[model samples]
Target: MMQRFIPLGNGYSDIYELMYIGRAMPERVRHMLVLHPFDENNPEASLALVMKPTNPGNFQPIYICLEGVPIPSKRYDLWRELADELQHDVIELTVSPSGKFSDQEIFFQHLIGILRTNHYLPRLQRSF
Candidate 1:
């Protein structure tokens, strides 16, 4: 399966897109994952929506707002409100800070691996 992250703005306006997508495609929405990773350098969080893949399709589109909004901070009120409104519990995971990674791509790769290992995503198959 293929996973794609669609970036959104880091403000209220951008957050609305997340809300809109969830509300508009409630059926397509499968799960929500919230990551709270922090270090001495920066404290932040990410919200990811795991939507159901299309029938017979290998693509699994994941809409995300990376550090879109300050998290674990009072600013996180918006995120809390979203979960409350959607009535979906956010699967919170504490991970290594993004700063620890050499780049954003690596950090995201680590997060995806975590999800896969935890069974959030399907594991790879091996054929002899």
Candidate 2:
């Protein structure tokens, strides 16, 4: 199966759109994740939605807002809203900030590693 990250703009007003997708596609929803990065100086958070492979295409999509929001420790309401809308538990993972990586590819590679380690994502060469 093929997998990729689809970026959604920050959690300003787009959050409603994100909620709509989760509520509308409950069957396709695989997991909801909150990624937090805490560096000595910089702290950030991102929300992501993982979906099951589509029929006939076998493509899995991971929708992400990237490191656009401040840490949820300061804004728990967003997390609560997301949990309520998805009607499922949200998994939280601490990871290195994307800014640490020189390129977007490297950042996503790091994310994939974290997801794999947590069993949220399939292992390399494993078919979905």
Worst 10 residues of 1 by lDDT: 67-76
Off by more than 4 A, model 1: 72-75, 125-128
lDDT of 1 at 17: 84
Cα lDDT of candidate 2 equals 0.77
* Overall lDDT per candidate, in order of appearance: 0.72, 0.77
TM-score of each model, in listed order: 0.79, 0.84
Regions of model 2 farther than 4 Å from truth: 73-76, 126-128
Steric clash pairs (candidate 1): none
- Clash number by candidate, in order: 0, 0
Worst 10 residues of 2 by lDDT: 71-80
lDDT of 1 by residue, 63-125 (tens): 777764566565467667767777777788877876788987787778778888887777655
For candidate 1, report its TM-score.
0.79
Look at candidate 2 and tell me the lDDT of residue 27. 83
Supply the TM-score for candidate 2: 0.84
Give per-residue CA lDDT, model 2, range 81-126, as digits (tens).
Answer: 7677768788888889878889977888788778878888887776
